[model samples]
Target: MTAVQLPELPDLPGKRFPRRVPVRQILCLVPLLLVTVVAVRHRSVLAEGFGQLRTAEWPWLLVAVGATCLTWVAAAFTRQGAVVERLPRRRLLATQFAAGAANHLLPTGLGASAVNLRFMTVCGVPLARSSAALALYLLAEAVGRLGLLAALLVAFPDALRLGTLLPHGAVGPLFAAVGAVLVVAAGVLVFVRRLRTAVCSFLRTALGEARSVHARPARALALWGGSLAFPALQATGLAAVGLALGLPVPPVHMALAYLAATVAVALVPTPGGIGSVEAALIIALVAAGGPAAVATAVVLAYRIITVWLPLLPGALTLGALLRLKVI
Candidate 1:
């Protein structure tokens, strides 16, 4: 050891390792990156949407824009209605807007659900209660949509020609498929003891929350009213776009087509129902007696206003919220 004495290392007690990365700062950049990627991926769509806007009737387009804005308000209201505790109003609205952008990034509404769940948890709601509220919101929304569809179908018998969109033989198979899925799900729930127990616990919590929410008249009204208004506004935005583009379809028929198309593709695992939604809308519009070209134009313009135009700003808001630790 004396023959080959090793050099002593410098005494650096606190500087032995590199500093940790700023994870929060890195997280803040993620939303911007996602926005850029999405915008680039759909550049053609963005261009076409803008072109459609140029040729559209501004008055109706403005109406569509207004309807689109109201949707966020409606979503906020519905979210509030799902829980007994009051959430920060401004942050709730901002969350809904950010959730819209998130929804387009993930398939089957997972992005939106995740954002809202996180937000609720941050607002001091328990995870189980937050989940139950989410389920309640979904159930209310679905009921509102289907109820509106049925009412519209009854009011205007010829609004949607289902025969054209779905072959007579297809209906049976579709129902059977849905039934089979339900049965399989039920069987799994029954066979899995742990899962069944967890589900039962969740159900009890959900029922209790539902009762608490309903006990308050204002909360109940907001929940059901907002749920109904959200889909109505969505359909209205689509109808307004159809009018702006001079599609040869009545406004009522256009609304009917939108509701039908959306419901048909509700289970489709597409990000924001992008391709499937467009195709379904066009087909439904055609079935509703609109020209295919005009229907396509309307769908493009509608998507632009509702999804594309606000996407960047929404993503920016999401990043800001993350930096602030609001969700």
Candidate 2:
């Protein structure tokens, strides 16, 4: 009954166990890193935006900023309205602001959608239901935007000169292109059994959710009202910027121009529609009878207030949310 003894190993000088970083800590840093990269990439734009703000009227600029803030609220409401279950009000609102930053970082609306999807899932929603809710929100938003644009066009037919915005005979080709894409998409959907089945299942789920939402009067109102207000607020922000910068276009005309420009460039895949939005907006304002220089200034200033100014704060919020495991 003898115990075996082993020799003790000497510790090597300057040798230490590597400190492991927590994955959560690393994830939190990811958002901040992304924010830094984005800010550096668009430094010139950010500088120009700040420079343009100097010439803007303080009162109107304040209105633009207010509208920008409210857009996040509207988005939060719309997101809530999409799902039947109630989400925490403050966290939902904060997520929208964070989503705004994410939207600017990713192409089209993917970033915002991703953030919302993650939030919904983290809040205990099923993945399929969250996806349906996201689709419903998008559909409602699109309809609201288009409906508002149509109403404005009817109210002020002369607000925008379509010919100035589009090249000669471009309309026919544009429609044809859209139709071709739709036809191709339809063909694929029809030919692929698995895809068609999946789409049908998704559609059924989305429709069910939509019906459930509409059945609740309060939810329905929030859904539609928020959807409509989101675009209106965005347009108002642009109009306010136009006024602040002394753009010659009327406020209503500027709103109309904003709606038109956004709709036209909705399909462009650029992150937050950055370049395309600026160019489209400038052309839209010019078509709405604004001087080219003033139109450019208005668009730049509007973007500054709406996008660049809040970006850092939004990014910080996103990082905090990640650290807290909110999404």
Candidate 3:
């Protein structure tokens, strides 16, 4: 609403940044429409799935929503905690919700992220400090995701099962899931430390180049970790959506999908990773061995629960934050 809090951000080396575009609600909604079309063409599947929803085990749905909400709330708390002087939980939560909306509506994933950093500045957080804090929050998120991936790999052998529908096609995804988890694990083991260093160094570089964006290395790491916890909590929400839809999908697969989808979309640079996330979700679900129809249903439902459901709250929060002069 207010002039976006974008001061020229410092440029960093080896950072593959996307060009920022004006936020376009229509562009963001297009993917939702595409998803609708894909979902509609599978009408019988929808009817079957929705019908199953009616008879669905209410316990699972309740638990799923609970977990989903908790995850984001945790995320809010995590970010709130990381600040030198804390932002109100309500404020953080509102920003997070608004960011989620922005992520969906803005194509480049940066829309919400960029907005938040600017908001932080508006809240009187210096650009360098706010930027570092959010970076740390993001780092934590990656760690949490990969940690879940490792747990799933070790704890659930067939974490990616494709219901009882297929003979053994599901096996491929099991391996794929394992492979994906292992890939992330290996990266963590080998590169995470270095990656942290790189991020810090990159921030320094960006600041040196752009002047406005800056963050201390240690603070950045801390904030990044804090930001990450919320993402880990999301597995419960995804699993819940599956349960609600009568998709016998595991929470682990949701974790895997979330990790894959989130990471993939971050790289995509589209606001909220719109097309990237939905498509990645479908692929991730399939990799987890969910039936095509079931994957479609669950992914759509998960997006609805996770993405759309929270938009209004976020928008309201964004407005409030602006009104209160908090960015």
Error of 3 at 304 (Å): 1.2
Candidate 1 lands at a TM-score of: 0.94
Q: What is the lDDT, from 0 to 100, of the residue 89 in candidate 1? A: 99
User: Which ten contiguous residues of candidate 3 have the minimum total lDDT?
Assistant: 209-218
- Mind giving the per-residue lDDT tens digits that candidate 3 earns over 127-238? 7777776665565566776676667667765755434323457669867997999899777757779776766776884444222211444434435554555666676677
Candidate 2 local lDDT, 2-104, one digit each (tens): 9899999997799688988798788767767877887798888878878889988999999999999999999999999999999999999999999999898
Against the reference, the lDDT scores of all candidates come to 0.93, 0.93, 0.62
- What's the candidate order when arranged by decreasing TM-score? 1, 2, 3
Q: Which parts of model 1 are misplaced by more than 4 Å?
A: 1-14
Better of 2 and 3 by lDDT: 2
Residue pairs with clashing backbones, model 1: none
For candidate 1, the lDDT comes to 0.93
**Best candidate, TM-score-wise?**
1
